[model samples]
Target: MKSIVTADGYHVPVLLRESVDGMNITPESVCIDVTFGGGGHSREILSRLGNNGHLYGFDQDMDAIDNLPEDAKFTFVRSNFRYLKNFMRYYDEDSADAILADLGVSSHHFDDSNRGFSFRFEESLLDMRMNSKHSKTAAKILNEYQEERLADVLYLYGEIKQSRRIAASIVNRRKTKSFKTVSDLLEVLEPFTGKAKEKKILAQAFQALRIEVNEEMEALKEMLTQALDILKPKGRLVVITYHSLEDRLVKNFFKTGNFEGKADKDFYGNLNTPFKLVNNKVIIPSEEELVINPRSRSAKLRIAEKL
Candidate 1:
């Protein structure tokens, strides 16, 4: 399957066919693509929909506006997916047959040096907000957060074992000169970025700051909870996660209807859940897909149906 590309090549959808196929679209089924970065998945969903079927594409990034498909069956919601329920209510949509979310950062973001999503752009300011209007930025978090809080962000979000030491270093260094640019933070992280794992450590540190700035985990939780409410019985929930943090939440939610991954048992020992797992095992990008879109190496697809 060839990767789908938008006019500006905003993103090449990862697990393109597999993710959309998991939706099990019907000609008249209404669907929602909550992460409409490049409209790759939404476009595919629209293609499968009949005239009566409607698809709502949600995105907070201003860049996504240019990629919107001009079709009567599609509506673009210019808001974060965390407010999925609120927007659905505002639009008078009671339920949807399918919902898809691709939780990876778009290629456009990483490729755009000004976004500061990639560590390679040392000259750029650390402004990693997906929605530029948001008040919080990576620079603010690095400069403002206390040592303990900063450590927690890196430890939990980035899974950096030396987070406390790193945070302390950052706090000590910022006393004289506050962090402003990617290079500022990079200088503080110098000790940790050894030759063998230089790129890996830097990537983790940047990811931590970006996640904190965007409140990604919280938003994902809110969106998933609302998805349960807005999906019709037997409706499908398909998600493509790029990291273990997001994948764990989606996996737990699908299997047990909670983030803790605990299963509730009835008298017959039946595992009670709002959703039935559509894929027992997670789906990863095929070798061919990885060759086509190398950034999709970490992509994992999971699907579930509302019971």
Candidate 2:
């Protein structure tokens, strides 16, 4: 397949060969790339598909539609993968041969400073909506949410130990001025930043806000549930998650075929699961790829097949 990475600097696919190859796609296979950020994986899937095969790429971000490859077999769905079943049914696909989802924010989000996915832009708006059309913004959550609720967002999503302290600081500061820009939030995070692990702490704070703004965990659960329904027997399901929260969900789902991670039991006490883990261990980016793309350092790829 031709390189999808263009001069304009779109996303550079992480774990490219590992992710695409994990799908086990054949010439006649019908596949789906649930988060077609830069069309890298979608393009690779298209290359393996024959004239009779079809590939669907789904993304709620309208900007991603522009990156869609102009191929007859490729169909770009401008919607979240949570609607996977609905779109698959609309297209009359009873089941897909393979399904792939690269979870969390894309490199494009961080690269484009205007998007507010990174802390690099102090004056930028706290608008971290994956789909710009969404109503909620990160600023709103920080300003309007109750202190306890804000603490939960930070503790649960960011996994910060001092979530309560952070939330208290945000609420107290926002009383004087509603947070409108990154600098406004950073000012409150002063005590947390400027330390040896300042970047990590700030990133966590931003991550919690971004995840809440986008409802990412909720969306991932919805999409994963629908994926099982759409995948054919023995079909491959590959997921690349960036954070431990999302990774835990994928790991539990792949193990027990549900989010709770409770293995189902049959009459004979044999475990019954819809999918089996292809890679028993998590796959991380190679040191070489890490050198080339530092953003991929946190990536963890997990592959499973429907039984």
Candidate 3:
């Protein structure tokens, strides 16, 4: 397998083999790789495809392009997978045989101090744009969100029990001065920070901003909507998610086509939803893989077939 990379060039792979194995690829299938960080997973998927098979990849970070292998059967979409429906038109059919997504930040993004994805880098810029051309920045989220709303994001998205204190700290500081980089936020978060504690907090804070900036949750819903409609009957969807929010979204959708799964069924007593779960249980990394790549610890793999 090839190496993993973040859009900014940091290298890490979350769940290397489990994700691809979930795809159930064949020589004749056409595949789409969403969140193509580092192209490690993409290369593995491509290896399974024959010359007649095709691979389509999407990443907002242009840096990921350099890592992509040159191939005639491959197409790369620079836009977010939210537009996956529109972009898939360029392929053999609007529908695909299989779809795979290894979601969340890349190794490159976390490792690059300049990008500031990690609390580990205090001196770095707070600019967490996967696409730098994108207007919203983490700094803006800190500077702009209403205190109550900000607290809600921290509480709900980041799961911070002390979200009130965190929000208060952010708002109070930003009023006196504009926060510029990762270090700026770290100073305010210093009191509550520790290795384990810091990771959860930083991930949550980063998630809220990244979601707002990239419209990630919305994009995911859109992709799910489009995917359910476009995938051929029995076509497979293999997803690897790193956080509970993402996992919850996939779990609900797989179970009920809607995240809440609250829809009422018809007289015939069917699922009222279209998805038929292929892997009824969510898949986790094996002990061996987890030992090698700790990042896979949080990874959750879910699979379903179009119904």
lDDT of all the models against the reference?
A: 0.91, 0.88, 0.79
Worst 10 residues of 3 by lDDT: 1-10
Instruction: Return the TM-score for each candidate structure.
Output: 0.97, 0.96, 0.91
The candidate maximizing TM-score is 1
Measured over all alpha carbons after superposition, the RMSD of each candidate to the real structure, in angstroms, is 1.9, 2.5, 2.8
For candidate 1, write residues 1-307 as lDDT tens digits: 1233446767678888899999999999989999998888898899999999999999999999988999999999999999999999999999999999999687788878899898888899899999999999999998899999999999999999999999999999989999888899999999988999998899899889989999999999999999999999999999988888988999999999999999999999999999988899989998998877877888889999999
For candidate 3, give the lDDT of residue 301: 83
Q: Clashing residue pairs in candidate 2, if any?
A: none
Per candidate, the number of residue pairs that clash is: 0, 0, 3
TM-score of 1: 0.97
Candidate closest to the true structure, highest lDDT: 1
At residue 113, candidate 1 shows an lDDT of 89
The clash number for model 3 is 3
lDDT accuracy of residue 27 in candidate 3: 91
Kindly list the per-residue Cα lDDT of model 2 for residues 161-265, writing each as its tens digit. 999998999998987899999999889988976789899899999999998998989999999999998898999999999888999999999999889899899
